[model samples]
Target chain A: MRTLILLTTLLIGACSAGPQPIRYGEDACNYCKMTIVDQQHSAEAVTLKGKVYKFDAIECLVHYVSPLDETTFSHLLVANYDNPGVLIDAKTSSYLISPNLPSPMGAFLNAFDDANRSSAVQREMSGELHNWQSLKRTITTRNQIPN
Target chain B: MSRGLSLILFFFLVSISTSVGNKLHVGQDKPYATIHSALAAATAGDQIIVHSGVYRECPVHINKSITLTGYGMPVLDAEGEKEGFIIEADSVTLEGFEIRNTGFSYIEDRAGIRVKRKHISSFRTTDYITLFFGIYLEHAKSGIVRNNALHGKPLGEANSGNSIHLWYCADIDIEGNLIRGHRDGIYFEFATECRIRQNISEGNLRYGLHFMFSNDDIYTGNTFRDNGAGVAVMFSRRIHMLNNLFHLNWGQAAYGLLLKEIYDAEIRENIFQKNTIGIFTEGSNRINYVDNDFLNNGWAVKVAGGCEKNKFHWK
Candidate 1:
C-alpha cells in the first residue's frame, strides 16, 4: 500500500512539469516592429538547461538566437492555427502559406506543429500539405505537376 | 599494276577519313563516353550525335566549338548532385535533350544550364558586366540553344533551381524550347544585346522569366503561364518585350509581371490575362507600356508607393 502511494506521487510530479505556457517577445517584432501578440504567431524554445524563451515571430527568433549555436535548442514550439490548443514540431511541420492566406505580413501561413493539425487546417482552408518529395515535384520547379 | 595500286590507295584513304570523323554514334548502346572526348575527336564542325540514354554525369565542360545533338530526348543526369552542363567555349549547339534531377542544397546554386558571359555587341567596351546564368557563356561570343526541354524538381526556397539560365552571353539565339519547374524558367542576369525568342515556360514556382540587373535585351514571341509568380524585371534598363503571352498566374498576390527598379524599357503588344494581379511595379522609372492587353486580372497594376518617372500609354 505504501509503494502504490509513492508511485502515484512520482506520476504527479512528472505531470506537473509538462510544458508551461510561457509568454515571450520584445515590445515589438525585431524585424517588422509591429506590437507582439503572444496568442498569434509567437515562438517558444526550450534550452538545454530546461529554460524556455519565447518570441513573437520566427524571424525575430532567428535574429535573437543568431551567433548562438542552434543545437542548444531542445524543444521548439509554434502555434497551430487550425487547432488552437496544440503545438507541434517546427522543422517537420507543413505550411499552407500563400499570398491569399491572410496574415499581418500580407497573406501567408506561419508555424504549424502537428501534421494531423496541418492536414485538418489545410482541408479547412482548401489547401494541400505537400511532403518534401512531392512538394519538390510541384513548386519551385521546371516540370509538369505530375498527374 | 600501277592502276590497281592507285585504286586500292584511293579506297583505303576514303575508309580512313570516314572512320576519323565518325568516332561516336548516336542511339548506340554504350556504357559512357565523355562529351568532351567525342567533341575533341570530332572535326571542326562535325556533329557529335549522343543517343537517347541517361548520361548519368555532368559538369559536362564544353571547351571546344562543336555540334552535339542527341537522338530523340536524351536524359543528361546531374543526379541533383552536381551543377548541370557547363559551357566554356564558343559556337556550340545543344538540342533535343532533357536535363533533370538536380541536387538540392542551401550553399550551391544548381542550374540546368549556365551561360557564363554577358551578351554585348562585338565592338562595345567591357565596362558593363552582368551576372552569369544557366546556359552560361563566360567570354563566349556566339552560341545557340534550340529545340530542347529542361525540367527540374526544386524543393523549398533553397532547393529550387533555375531552368534555362544565362549570363554574360551575347548574340545568342534560344528558340522553340519548353522549360518548366524551376525558380525562373528563363533567367537573364546580366546578358545584354541578346535575343530570346519562341519559348514556352509554365508551372514554375517563381518568375516565368526573371531578368535582374541586365540591359539592352530583346524578348519576343514567348509564352509564360501558370507560374507561382509570373515575371520579374529588377534593376534592369533598356529592355524590349513584345508579342508575349502572360496568363493564368493565379495566387493571392501573384502578378502577370513585376517591374521593380527598372528604367527606359518598352513593353508593347503583350497579353496579360487571368492573373491575380496584372502588373506590380515599384520604383520602376522612365518606362513605356504601349499597346499591351490586360484582361480579367484582379488588379491591372499596383504602384506600391515607391514609383517615379514612368509612363504607361494605352493604344
Candidate 2:
C-alpha cells in the first residue's frame, strides 16, 4: 500500500509538470494586479516545478521576471500579437516598440511570432524592433528609477 | 432724490447681471453648429447648453472655465472611435450628458470625458489602476462631474478602462453617475480629498471601485455589483469607506473588498453580500472595520499573512 501511494504521487507530479493554460478574465496578473483578460497581450512563465505566473501584458511578464532568478523559470512565453491568446516561446519571440501600438501599461510594446512579423509593423509604424534579450534590457533600463 | 433712486436701481441690476452667467445654446440652426465653435466663442463663467441631439463630436477639448450643461441629456457619441471631451480648465462643471462609444486602444487610454493638467511624473508609479478610462481626471482641482451616464462595451478578459478615473486630482466631486461596462467602475490614483457619492457602478470587468496611493479620500453610498472584484484599496491610507453596498461579485479573484498594504483607514457600515470573499487583507495595518454586515459570503474575511493592529466589530 505504501509503494502504491508513492507511485501515485510521482505520477500526479509528473503529469502536472507542464505549462497550464492561463485562466483569462478570471486570473489576476501576479505582478501588476490587472486581470489577465487581453489574450492578445497576455504572458506567462512557468517554473521548473510547474508553478505558473501569468501577467496581463508582455512587459508585465518581463517586469515580473526581471527581479527574479532566471534559473527557476523553465518556460517563458508571450501571447502572439497576430494570433491573439496563443502563447509563443519568449526566448525567440520578436518585439516591436512603437508609439502607435500602446500596450496596456502604456509601454508601447508588442510581441510577435517572429522577426519578420515584428518588422512588418515596424515598417509602417516606424518603431524599433527587438528580440527577447534586447527587449528585456531596454525595458529594465528604461524602468529603472533614476537617482 | 430722483437721481439717487436711479443710481440705487442701477447698482441692484449690476449685481444681478454679475451673478448670472451668459448662456450659449447649441443645436441645429443655432448660433453655433458644433460645440467646438461655441466653446471658442465662450468666455469664463459662461454656460453652454446642448440640446437633445446626437452630436458625433469626439475630442471636445474644453480649455476654459465654463459650465457644459445638457438640457435634455444630449448624446455625445464618439462613434466607437475617439474620445468625447478633454476638459483642461479648472472649476469646470459638466452635467447631464450621456457619453457613448468610447473606443478601444492598446496604446492610448481613450475616454468619454478627460480632464487633465501637467502632473508630476512620480505620481504614475503609485497607480494601481490600468489604462483606457471612461471619465478620466488628472491633476485637476475643484471640478464637478455630476449626473452623467457613461455606457461602454468594455472587454472582459483584460482591462478596458475605468468608468470614472481620477489621477493626481484633489477636491473633485464625482457624484451621481451611472457607470457600466468598463474594466474598473471607478478608479483613483494619487487623488486626495475627493468625494465620491451615490454612484451605481455595475457590470464591470474588474473592480467596481479601486484606488491606490491616494490618501484622505471618501467613498459613500455607492453600489457595486457584478464585477470581477468589488473594490480594491491598495497602498493607501486615511480613507473613509462608508455606507457602500457590494454584492454578487463572484469569481476566484473577486472580493467584496480587497485591501493590500493599506493603513490607518476606517471602513464603516458597508454591506458585503453574496461575494466570493467579503474582505481579503494582506500586508495591511491599522484599520478599523466597524458596524459592517458580511452576509452569505464564501469567506467573510480572508486574512493573509503580515496584517497587524486590525479591529473588526459588527452588530
Candidate 3:
C-alpha cells in the first residue's frame, strides 16, 4: 500500500511535469520543489529551456507541475531520482521504478546508462539486479503490498 | 335547494366530469397498439394500462406526466441494441413492467430508463422523486423511482453499464429494488438531497452505489454484496450513510467504501465484511464515523493525511 501511494505520487508528478517550469503554488520548481535533497518533500523539474531542477522529494515538484496546462509544455526531463547529475527524459527514464524499492515512497533506480554503474547501485541497494523490462514488469505487477 | 334544482345540478356535474379526459384504458376500442403508442397520445393526469406481452423495441420517449401500468407483466426489450426508456416528462409512474436487454456501448452511457427534468428557471420546475430505477434520471428534479428490478451482465469495464444512472438530479428516492450484474448498480453525479433505502445491489463490476459532486444525500438500509467495490462518495458534501451492508468486495485496489475530498459527512451503522478495506478515506474531513461494524475486512479503516476531526465511535 505504501508502495502504491508512492507510485501514485510519482505518476502524478510525471503527468504534471511538462517542458517549461511552471511556478506551482507558493514554491519554486516546476516539477518538484526541493529546499534540500534528503527531505520528504524534495522534487525535480525540467523546464522548456533545457534546464533541469532536482528536489529532495516528488511533492515539491507536484506543487508546481500539477496545475500546469498540458498543452503549453515542450519536453519532459527528470534527474534519475537515484543518480543525480545523470538526467534523462521522464518517459525514457527506466531506472525509477514503482514497487520493490527500499525507500518509503517505493521508488528505486533499476538501471543506469553504464552497466557497471547499475550493478554497483544494485549491490548497494540489495536489489535483485533485473534489467529494465524486468524491473518495469515487477513494478506494474506490484499493485498491492502486504499490509 | 329544491328537488327540481338539485336534479339539474346533478346533470351539469356529470357533463363536466366527462370532458376532464383522465382515464385511458389499453386494449379498448382505441386501445393502444403498443406501450409506446399509448405513451405518445397520453396527457398529464392520464392513465395507460397495457396488456401482457413482450415489446422488442427501441427506447420509448415520454415527455408528459402520466401513469403507465401493466395488467400482466409487460416486457420492453431494447434487444440489446438500443437504450430502454427515456422520460423527459415529469410526474411519471411506471409499474408492473419488465425492462431488459439494453444496448451496450463503451462510448455511450445508456440504461433502462433515463429521466430528464426541466431547468430551474423553466416554467413549472418542481422537485420530483424517482422511487425506483430500472429508471434512470438525468438533470431531473425530485424523481421517485421505486419497486423495480434491473439486471444485466458485464463483460469488462468497456462493455459494462449502470443499471440506474442519474446525473444532475435532486430529491431522489431509490427504494425496494433488486439491481445486479451491471458496471455500477447505481451512479449519480452533481445531484443532491436524495435518499436511497431498502435496496439490494449485488454482482456489479464496479460500485454498488457511486456518486460524485453530490451533497445532502442519505443512503440507508441498502445491501451491497459481491460488488467490485461497495460504494464510492467523492467530491461531495454533507452526506449521510447509515445501516447499509458492504460485503465480499475483495480485490486489489478494492474497498467497501472510497471517500475522497468529502466534507462534513456522516457514516454510521453500516456493516463492512470481507472487503479489501472496510473504508478508505483520503482527503476527507469533519466526518462522523459512528458505530459501524467492520468484520473480517483487510482493514477496518485506512485513513490518509488531510483527514481531520473525524470521529469513530465504538463498533
Taking chain A of model 3 alone, its TM-score versus the true chain A equals 0.38
Error of 1 at B170 (Å): 2.7
Tens-digit per-residue lDDT, A1-147, candidate 2 = 999999999988885686779877788888756667777788899998788889988988998998889889899999888886689999889999997775655467899987987898899888899988888889987832111
Which one wins on TM-score? 2
Q: How does model 3 score on DockQ?
A: 0.03
Regions of model 1 farther than 4 Å from truth = A1-147, B1-23, B26-40, B115-140
Docking class of 1: incorrect
How many clashes does each candidate structure show, in the order listed? 33, 4, 27
Instruction: Give the Å shift of residue A116 in candidate 2.
Output: 13
Q: Could you tell me the lDDT of residue A87 within candidate 2? A: 96
- Model 1, position A94: C-alpha lDDT score: 68
The C-alpha stretches of model 3 lying farther than 4 A from their native spots are: A1-147, B1-22, B27-30, B119-134
What is the Cα-based lDDT of residue B142 in candidate 2? 65
Q: With candidate 1 superimposed using the best TM-score fit, by how many Å does residue B71's alpha carbon deviate from the native?
A: 2.3
Model 1 residue B18 distance off true place after TM-score fit, in angstroms:
11
Alpha-carbon runs more than 4 Å astray in model 2? A1-18, A31-34, A38-42, A57-68, A78-147, B1-20, B118-132, B155-159
DockQ of each: 0.02, 0.30, 0.03
